[model samples]
Target: MNLVALAARCRAEHDYNPLCDAIPYVRFLGISVSEEAGEFISQLAFRPRNIGNPALPALHGGVVGAFLETTAILELVWAQETLMIPKIINITIDYLRPAGPVTTYARGTITKRGRRIANVTVEAWQGDRSRPVAIAHCHFLLELTP
Candidate 1:
């Protein structure tokens, strides 16, 4: 489906936020989002395009970083219910282990939120949540809607 149509469907459902689906980079990465109750979950499908090393066939660090950042933004949008997109201030990512060629999952938590800024913690795991492939801490400058 086209981005506009997908976004319209998302709005009609009033569940998952369409901001992630609307972005071209997120779409290129093939990210899928779902919301259960108030919690948000994002998934990255395993694809050859995402592979960085031909030897190990591991996921690129950039892809994982983008996934985590997207997760943070999606979580913030879902929690705040705002139309304005948040500007990322800083992102610190720690690569824990190699991300194999498999479906990866990411979850972000809004640790703190103020008037103009919010801190989010995100973790991406392939096989187990207890052992994350990468973790990221992101600070975003929120734009408030009038």
Candidate 2:
């Protein structure tokens, strides 16, 4: 489905699975979203293929980074009632700690949203919300329709 159609379905059904399903990378990473207390919480399910270091059994840095970015994009989509898909202009991710072979959760907050740009910050954690394994600051270009 196209992004516009997917966005319509998401809004109609009050679900974001269609949006996630439309992205192959999001599917490959096993990323899913749920609404908790009026906030969108994204989850990265544990998968053996995602392990980058067999010795440490840690998730790949790239996987974590991608998850965080995806979370930010989804948050933007969920928060806005627009059909446009936010395009990532740039993202900076900080790997605070190694992610173990387990599920990870992330939440993104929009620091600023303008007519054509948005800034989002995301935090990914495992087991504890207070301690984040990774954090990301992302800037996306919003497509404004006349």
Candidate 3:
């Protein structure tokens, strides 16, 4: 379905990401949900505050990692279309280049889902979708004791 249709459906169902709802910062960052390969995709764009320091002047590695993880979790949550939260096991990120000062976007795709584990990959980029600034491989364990 198209974005408008997706939004309508989500509105009709009244489904939302609790994680996104919980973090006001995330909402402030302008993270949005969209359709991807007939599934929901979480998107993150760059802001001045998310910009890098004066010394190095590039996006922080930790920020990139967090974006990847959040995107991956959104992928899982989108696939499930439920309220229960999932526990992530491990996430590995590879930085390809320095993400420019412009707004960057993050997207996640799930490759495999098993009884207990799900494999996901996420990409973040700016300007050149041809070359991603970072790519992440994530392994998620659905249920875990707190």
lDDT: which candidate is best? Answer: 2
The order of the candidates by lDDT, greatest first, is 2, 1, 3
Give the top-scoring candidate (TM-score). Answer: 2
**Model 3 misplacement above 4 A:** 1-19, 36-39, 81-83, 144-146
lDDT, candidate 3, 1-146, per-residue tens:
43334433555564544456555666766576666456565666666677666465777777778878878877776666223455788989999998766667777788888777889999888787788999999998765322
Q: Order of candidates by TM-score, top first?
A: 2, 1, 3
lDDT score, candidate 3: 0.70
TM values, all candidates: 0.87, 0.95, 0.75
How does each model score on lDDT? Answer: 0.84, 0.90, 0.70
* Residue pairs with backbone atoms closer than 3 Å in model 2 (clashes): none
Candidate 2 lDDT (Cα, whole model)?
A: 0.90
lDDT (tens digit, per residue) of candidate 1 on 39-131: 678999999999998799799999999999999987876675344667899999999999999999999999999888899999999888999
Per-residue alpha-carbon lDDT of candidate 2 for residues 23-137, written as tens digits (9 for 90 to 100): 9999999999888788889999999999988999899999999999999999888987234888899999999999999999999999999888899999999999999999999
Clash count per candidate: 0, 0, 0
Mind sharing the TM-score for model 1?
A: 0.87
